[model samples]
Target: MGAVRETLDAVRLVDHHCHGTVAADLGRDAFESLLTEGEAWPGISPFDSPAGVAVRRHCAPLLDLPRHTPAEEYLARRSELGRREVQRRFLRAAGTDVFCVDTGYAPDPLTTPREIAEAAGGTSYEVVRLEGVAESVQTAGVEPDAYADTFRTAALEAVRRPGVVAVKSVAAYRTGFDLDPARPSEVEVTEAARRWFARGGRLDDPVLVRHLLWTAVDLGLPLQLHTGFGDSDIRLHRADPARLTDWLHLTAGTIPVLLLHCWPYQRQAAYLAAVFERVYLDVGLTLHHVGPARAGGVLAEALEITPFRKLLYSSDAYGVAEFFHLGALAFRQGLAELLQGRVDADELSLPDALRIARWTGRDNALRVYRLEADGPEDD
Candidate 1:
């Protein structure tokens, strides 16, 4: 195969699945510095749903509750200042127009039934939503089966607000992943899954996966599922892409499934993508954990194996803004470098780049969330 050279627009790129909420918590200055340092950083954002917001509110306290007094539990809590700060930083660094938010996992905050995301004219921050695979059951104490109803209602209510674009779902963890092998099992493994299942989870049952997929179709939403190695508590093999066969079989003909971070099983995930019409994949954990040195190879593999249109970008950006922004930049540039100079690089040609850039980012999101055409405009 001949090497293919592709040019790119000045905009850099879009990161489909970043947790800007955590980055936003890092404060504005740190966020700005990180973006300024990383030239390739395209966009930064998060799900920022009610569960996300609650996570923002309670993370510190949750961590400190054990050491601190119960009464002072609320004192360690911080704010979502990082969300606004990330916006400010993105505007300053990339000038990109959108930052897709993950709203499916969160219920509508009590203060507002749905606060549609809005972008300021010429401002870098525009809140976009990816609905589905909500955390309502885990966060709001709702039943597992009711996830569909709660998610559909919340999505309808939120999408009506404009900036809402798509629905994103997750099935990777009841607890968090332990990336560092040194500190393992600090988090209870099956217990978290049990907690999640107690509310409304059925990871072992193929029927549950089908039910979730049907719920996506019923709501006419695109689903983004977490598939790859995750926190220590999660069974690594359970996160395999093969287990999603039932889901793939059910939705292959209709609803779009944006597979999020099929890391250890990247090849398997890409194979699945090739076979499924509606199956697309994004690079989240790969970018965050793989780093720039290896990201190029990973991107090349994804581009070579999956159709360009089926490929998407994401930061899976987490922690503080600076760290997240750097991770995002590493991914965008890594992809460009891997696909730009090679003649056989059909995967990263300028056209494919644009498709992955513009269409894959929010357009795919729109199609998945059923927010296309008649959905509300930006808030």
Candidate 2:
């Protein structure tokens, strides 16, 4: 117990897939909204939920409050500290060594990758969102005949930026994983672009989406796919990573394909990771949402058949700074309990448990993202 817990406590994490925190101070309603994947409604508060309770139990202490502090009290204390102070306390307390931030989804002003690192005390790398790049190409206006080449060029250039480590797709939100596994031909792309340009809003055209995904393979960077359990926009059944079996097979041997957040479908995700050489997964969003108490259950399901090296840690912590602390706390507590129990039962040894802790929390991310060559940024 002492060995594994101590090892994980000291391990510095690489948040392989996350989004920026809000730069502005938030009121109760606004802060609560970020705590949930669902919208706020009358008679319901995110404070009553698992994620909210976790914030009070776990994050309260970081803000100089006791565990299980009441929601109103918690927010009042946060207000007294100022948003920047609150953000600094939580981010620094998270002890994350590197942040691979998805710099795309910004409905509100968010800290940039550099700003996040500056606040959190570590290096920050960018994860380009393929959908954002495609939409940018749309905004820049490309001829339908040239749309395929134009988007490909834009995506290519986006990943080539300094400190850019990976690319992400919200295909789960935009279309779903049930699309045809084959890459859309140039003619199909041009035709889709013609319809898309005429409609001119969000890029949900299945053909164009396929083009974007295939282009990610061509870009030669690890690809992160949003799979399972997001907001109302996701058709849950279609977001299952198993639905991506055909696509994964087609893109085999290209680059690492990371499945993010997988909650209800974690077993399905585990199956994919066990079978596919390049497939990897993290139950990031699930941790803070389930809270530390239930994190072990979610992690157990995710590790049922997932190869030891295939699992990674992430927060998927967007909008709120408390998630940064809660996510890491849950990971440490849940993983420590699970691995320590295995060692107690003689199913695992202490040394092996410690190694697994390091791999999942930090080393695997550096290996997958190829960030090892950069050495320690603090050095």
Clashing pairs in 2: none
Indicate which candidate wins on TM-score. Answer: 2
Error of 1 at 175 (Å): 11
The sequence of per-residue lDDT tens digits that candidate 1 reaches over residues 270-356 is 888888888888777666455555667777676667865677766554433333343454565666566565525453455555555
In angstroms, how far off is 355's CA in candidate 2?
A: 0.8
Give the winner by lDDT: 2
Q: Supply the global lDDT for candidate 1.
A: 0.47
